[model samples]
Target: MTGPTTIGAAPYDALLLFSFGGPDEHDDVMPFLRNVTAGKGIPDSRLAQVAEHYEHVGGRSPINGQNLALMAALRAELSRRGVELPIIWGNRNWAPYTRDALIELRDRGATRVLALVTSAYSSYSGCRQYREDLALTAGSLEEELGHDLGLRFDKVRSYFNHPGFVAGNTDAVVEAYEQLRARGADLANAPLVFVTHSIPDTMEDASGAARPSYRTQHLDIAAVVAEQAGQRLGVDLTWSLAFCSRSGPPSQPWLEPDVNDGLRELAAGGTTAVVLAPIGFVSDHMEVVYDLDTEAMETARELGLTAVRAGTVGTRPVFVEGLIDLVLERAAVERGESPARAVVGRLGPVADACLPGCCRQRAGVDSGVPALCGQD
Candidate 1:
């Protein structure tokens, strides 16, 4: 662990809340879609077709508002704890951009800033893009502000193993179990299916310091939750991973067995009921709402299998505390102090920033962020 800086930390320091922004209105949908799919060669027609998914939900994604609510909750939590960090929200493809937030932090005399991105896994979009955003935004600030504003930025590490995260997700699954019981549903032999957004298999295979275990990580969380739920409720629960919200071309292989296919199999195999725990995501984004709630639910109904979807661990008090713990844990390491809490032992380097070889950006498309601060 590195020692804490002797220089007094700034009083007006900011904690930038970064997220993958969503379209709030109908008209913003196409443009927001473009930003998200930049460099993918996805034509507007394809995006327009996909826009129908958003249109189904009134052309507004719950992500932006959910992120705002999380930010507010985090601010309140920090304030109550007397942490005194000013938090500002920014989106990658919507209002309150990285450059704008950097200027705001600068205007508020925040020389040192901490960034907390909504993503919790290793990948280009999840980890590297935010750093790229910061670098680009900071460089732009140097030109716009007419001064070299040296900004020191640090981010929190993935919190998949945090106790609060585990506890919150476990509680969500347990609550869903209770709800099923209330509705006269038998969960004694329920199939526990854990779902996550399906990224390209190549991407998943290449993530992290070692080989990425994106699929395995989610499964690990699901196993813990399933064990606890089964132990408490005295039920036999078998868990498996399913992919959802896959939009790339058919040739570009993504993670599988698709949720719908999984449901079909479970139903054919004499599985009476299923409880889907979204361990791969942090919030109830469009993927969770439309993909799981709408599409998966319809499929399960058609198959005559009772399906119950668990909610995400979004802005739960324990989840917020988990975020705080992640930050403090990283800060402790940076300050050369041993973390008070024990993290799950996994194969990976111990740095908040992604490694140079981690999450290689696609060719012909600027990653919009450099791999590391000093490397590029």
Candidate 2:
């Protein structure tokens, strides 16, 4: 720590790296699935089937280690930016839970802690659910600790459109393009297929009353990234957005053009090579490693289409710098100062606090849950 860790971190004593947790081992798989689906009424039979995804990946998800690396990167970034703040981590499940991280922050004598969630979009699972968990943990700890800890929580605004994030994804796609070209793939007319996790139709409608919905945000980022990467490669690149990891039942419709389906369509339509960019994910989590790398790549292989999966913004310097910038921006807002928020495409910077009815079950249906880090 070359400089004091508290330089530009006023109005915020610490930064919390909030994320979704994963299984630590084979035995922890079913239990972790239970933790993830605690209230979903998912049976062990179904969960065990889903647990195969975890088991396939060496019985542990890459999320936990990626998160730790991100925390370390954020710490270094804060110090480099002349802002030092302790970076504490917490998860929605598994070890070192959110409540535990809160305790650590409280023990550090922190009053106001800013959370930088791993998810960068605005949706139920990605955004509001985390806020809901934070509220639940804070409320529970409030009762247990009795005394006034003066601790409060605020989260940085969604950075799906942040310049650094878009640039990172853009660079990743370009790298993937190079990878395919190196593999004897004809890239003179390859389409850039952007892939992301699909959300339910209801959730898509529920996401964007105030800000960009889940689908819309991805589309926005995908368009910008495609153009940027195309210009970099000097190729007249055409691109389309596709989805993966849709866990919904067949009766219910989630986002369409599944990456596999899209790849087959492309191959049938005479598009032989593609660069698959997982723009929606911020790290090489299960969704990226398994869904895109393993499953989608297999589909491309079967179709005889040359393809390569792009990296996520995991610990990338630009993305890390953008997160630190978001922290400082939020701190400025807390101090009643308006700071410039940098974004790439159409959507501007979102509000620091979530508004009422934002990311609800429906346009007008709020969960009636007492969520923190928002005006509502």
Measured over all alpha carbons after superposition, the RMSD of each candidate to the real structure, in angstroms, is: 4.0, 1.4
Q: On a 0 to 1 TM-score scale, where does candidate 2 land against the true structure?
A: 0.97
Backbone clashes, each candidate: 4, 1
Local accuracy of candidate 1 as per-residue lDDT tens digits, 1-376: 2333322223226778888888898998999999888888999989999899997789988898899889888877765555667788888888877777877887888776777888876666677777777777777778886888766787777667667777888888988888788877888778889888888877676554343567766766677778877888888777888989887879988889999999999999998788888887889988898999899999989999888899889999999977866655665665676766645535333356554565654422444454433233
lDDT by residue (1-376, candidate 2, tens digit) is: 4646574778888889999988778888898889988987878999888888886689899998999899889888877777768899999988789989988998899988999888888988888889899988888888887865577889999999998899888889889988987887767688889888998888888898777788998888888998888889887679899999888578988988899999999999998888888888999988888898888989999998878788998988988888888889899888889888888888787788987777876777867787888878
- lDDT score of residue 150 within candidate 2: 75
Q: Please, what is the whole-model Cα lDDT of each candidate in the order they appear? A: 0.76, 0.86
Clashing pairs in 1: 1-336, 2-335, 2-336, 132-369
**TM-scores vs. true structure, each candidate:** 0.90, 0.97
